[model samples]
Target chain A: MPVFPRFTALAESLPPTVPFVGPEAQERTRGARFIARLGANESGFGPAPSVIEAMEQQAGLSWRYGDPENHDLRERLGAHLGLAPDRIVVGEGIDGLLGLIVRLIVEPGTPVVTSLGAYPTFNFHVAGFGGRLVGVPYRDDHEDLDGLLAAVKRENAPLVYLSNPDNPMGTWHSAAAISRFAAALPETTLLVLDEAYSETAPVSALPDIAALADMPNVLRFRTFSKAYGLAGQRIGYVFGNRETVSRFDRVRNHFGVNRLGQVAALAAIEDQAWLSHVIALVVASRDQIGDIVRGHGLKPLPSATNFVAIDCGGDGARARTIMDGLVSRGVFIRMPGVAPLNRCIRVSTGPEVEIDIFEQALVEVMAELNGL
Target chain B: MPVFPRFTALAESLPPTVPFVGPEAQERTRGARFIARLGANESGFGPAPSVIEAMEQQAGLSWRYGDPENHDLRERLGAHLGLAPDRIVVGEGIDGLLGLIVRLIVEPGTPVVTSLGAYPTFNFHVAGFGGRLVGVPYRDDHEDLDGLLAAVKRENAPLVYLSNPDNPMGTWHSAAAISRFAAALPETTLLVLDEAYSETAPVSALPDIAALADMPNVLRFRTFSKAYGLAGQRIGYVFGNRETVSRFDRVRNHFGVNRLGQVAALAAIEDQAWLSHVIALVVASRDQIGDIVRGHGLKPLPSATNFVAIDCGGDGARARTIMDGLVSRGVFIRMPGVAPLNRCIRVSTGPEVEIDIFEQALVEVMAELNGL
Candidate 1:
């Protein structure tokens, strides 16, 4: 069949592939579900009971579209952050919001800066919008903040993405270093600070919300997916100067955030007890995974987020084998896609049952790989 | 404060104001909620009991992100629509999907055509992407099909939006007329045939799926929001030529669709018995609204949608008066924004209680408008 001939030149030139292959897609190929679902950094602990109750109550009200303004949630988020509601804009997820930000500023050839092996979704959005990406490779297992800042200035980039408590490597920078990087960025360069894993990070890892609230060029992105266990709901919010944040209204899908996500996020925010409990669980699971990796003679990196990245004592090829072996043994986990970082396999903190499976599977996979 | 200095010239120039001021915003401003929430055209009938049950059951599993591939929903949607799974792509909702399509095809200076008072959300997406809009005015309370086609060709528009079983007016074109329009459009002009209200439309008013399936340039958009009563879930899917549909993945937020939306939509599709029952209820409610409008000597357009557009036998000013009066009386309803069409008010079909409040409020407001 002849294809439609109306796609923009940029869209037509794009590849017909995605950054991440979902576990379900793999399951379809493998013809079996993973015995342990710890691959995607989701909170296997799930959301609060109050959040489930809130969703159930709001489910019947599903006939009505969510408030386009996302009023109540923003107000609550503002109170919690000590910022005004106008400074916050709630969106589908950080992924969805990233796409919008990229669209707003990125035209063909607009320069963007990010870590080389950081979040692929941010890079995907940049490429989708024709932004020129300049990647600064990680130094010492952390996103090279100085390198990224240098690139932003070198390219005179309009946009830059930095994920504190970074993913894939399970590493983070101190709040002071991150704040310094933000301050050094040219005012013309907008900083997209993705804190999707913020809830799972230590207090020292996150900048005070007010610290960046006054910067028109910096927007902090956070989500309910990690510590709150609401990844399936696709709710995330961005906060910054009112002027920059208000620009979101010019392009956002006004009613894009679903009704249930709004209610669930509201309830999750109120249930601080659940959040604290999950944090403890995540801490324990991280430690447990670290112990197992160490016992197996693999080096586990210190983690500030919900997942740990373990160095396999070899290169990407060896890491690939370990990942494949684990998958074959009924474990589903992800690893970085690029060099250097790809030498490590990333595992998310989950329930004891899942961690136990990963522990058992890792030992067997290691023996099998050694035998091979 | 000076806004972010790096916003694209186009982004900075776009207006801060939006087209539709949601009722929730109004209630917040007025410090009160509306007694009859009839303005947004939501299904007060609510989702199927089975769908709510599915969502409740899946609530605890919110740890996992929704399938980025939307594998199961797309498969089920393809089976339901008689298209290949590759032909269908699901997103956050019709609103979110519309943004993707606009981004894929529209760049600055691209002329996009639509009815003068058609869905504002589509126009918002177009403007957000800097598309030049050419709006064809409605004729005799219906989307002027010929006018739209003429504009599409005259402007060499790359995209045109046609909502069969249209919004605000709730009027529909016959299946034959719709098919003819689709065939008449130049293959270069991509048609966004929004069928969000298709489930509530009479079968005769809908084109055979296979009839237009071969047209690579014509994409039909559908939603589970209307008859299925899953509006809060924010799930909508679009299907067309496999190659054209595949372009969505090039730019869409891979995980924007909520997890429960997938579960709810799958269950909604499976619960066809409940869908038929909602159809019956919507049909009855449409008649009930018509009768109530006629009792006040108002003219209600024959509708193939879940809402009835009542002609108030006056100009936009008078219609505004009646609408504002009803809103003040705690009844929420909407009217089209443009001339001739704005001479009528639109009300969505809901349960008897909401309909009763709307009916009673309309009579009292009309009497006051007439100085009775």
Candidate 2:
């Protein structure tokens, strides 16, 4: 049958596609679950028990919609970060918030800048809004700040995205470099500093909340999904200048955040001891992954994020083979999507058992694939 | 500090306002919790114990992102509705889904059609997309289908919203009338048939899925929040022509729905026994509320929804005073936002304890407001 007749021209012209095919989809296709799930970069150590307890306790309150203003969670987050509540806007997740920000700036043919393979979801949102994308390929396995800046200037891009302690390659630039990049951007360009992995990064790698707090052109995204292990809860927040964050209120699904997520996030925020313990576990797991990757004769990239990227001594096709091999063997890991970076496979930090399974599967799969 | 620069002119022009204020916000303002939580139309009876158990059991697995495609939930929902999986799209909630649909159709100054006092979130999304709204006021507290069709034709609206078993007024049109209305709308005007309250409604009020299934311009929205009692979980789905539903894939946050919400919704969908139990409670409570309204000398509108809207035998002003009196005395109820409809106070069905509290509060509140 013919589709709805009135989708906007941009929507009509767009193809039906998604940024990422989830592991669940793969499992369904394969008709079996992966023995070790490391593909999505989700925390395998799971949420703090206290946070779980809090969510379970309030499970009965599922009858109530979450606060439309998201008042208490925002107030608590504000107090925790030493920012005013007006400076923060909580959302379904960074994914949902990114869509909102893209809508706020991108009209038909508006230009947006980001690394070619930095975050496909962000790019998907830009395309969804009919924005023209200017993707600068990564330099030195890290986002090319200078290149992104040049592209933004040339295209007069209104939005640019950079993830600190970045994804896929799991490499990071120093906070100083990021701050300089933010300062160099034209006042008209908004930088979306996705700090989704900041909880596990070294303190020096992160800018203080106040360092970029006053920059209306810079908004940093954070999520409980990382070290807090509430990825499934779909809670994330972005805070910046009060005026910028306030604009989100104008268009957001006011009651979009669920009741359990609000409670889970609030409790997760309070359990700082658990966060610290999980960071320690993440650090240990990253080291263990590096050791295993090196043992396989692959060069493990230095990482401040929860995952380590191991150069596979080949191209994107070779890396895809390894990724597929791991999944077929019931060990799920991911790799970068573009060239240069795609020469590496990314393994996320997880509990010891899952990591051990990955370690065993990696050796066997590599041996079989290489005909060693 | 200056705010972010380069927001689209449309975005910059919007007011930073929310669609609805939650009862939690009211409690914070009053410095006391509502003794009777009847606002927001949430199922105060709460989700089934089995549903809560499922959530609690899955709490530890909150580390994984939900399937971006929401595969299992969609497949199960498709099976439940005897439709193909391609015709269903699960989302954060009905609200988020509506925002996506509006974005797909409405550009700046595009005309949209809705009832004068229909879902405010729908209006909010239309404005967010810079669409001009053409509203038809309710006729006798029910959506004026004739008027809506006239407005759509007059304005050449590309989109229209109609909520079956409607909110705020709790009135509904029969299936024949709704089908006629859908047939009357221009095919160019996509119709959003919101059945968010469908489960609580009488069968006579709902059009057969087969009747609207093949209509390219028609989409039906349903949620686990109402009869299934999973509001805090934030899971909702929309179904229509396969081509129409597929359009959501281009822009939806692939991973927007939460994992536990997926699990909870799946379990809720399977537990028809529990749904029947909740439906019974809602029916009894609705009747109880109707009796109370009659005893108080207020006229109760017949509701096909889970809430009862009682006309206070006065205008919006008197209804507002009565609503405020209830709020001041620790009752939480909402009145319609627009006039004519605003002449009534809406009360959501809840457990007997909450209903008793509402019954007691209404008598005292009315007496105090009328200076008895």
Top-lDDT structure, candidate number = 1
For each candidate, C-alpha RMSD in Å?
Answer: 1.0, 1.1
- The DockQ-derived docking category for candidate 1 is high
User: Over all chains combined, what TM-score does candidate 1 have?
Assistant: 0.99
What's the C-alpha lDDT at position A112 in model 1?
Answer: 92
Fnat for each model: 0.92, 0.96
Q: Write the per-residue lDDT of candidate 2 for residues B107-157, one digit (tens) a residue.
A: 999999999999999999999999998889999999999999999999999
Give model 1's share of reference contacts: 0.92
Which tens-of-lDDT digit does each residue in A1-372 have in candidate 2?
A: 676778899999898778888998899899999999988889999999999999889988888888878899999999999999989999999998999999898988998998988888998998999999898999999999999999999998889999998997888988899999999999999999999999988888898889999998999999988889999999999999988888888888888898899999999999999999999998999899888888878888898888889998889888888888888989888888888889999999999999999988889889987799
Q: List candidate 2 stretches off by more than 4 Å.
A: none
In Å, residue B2's CA in model 2 sits off its true spot by 1.9
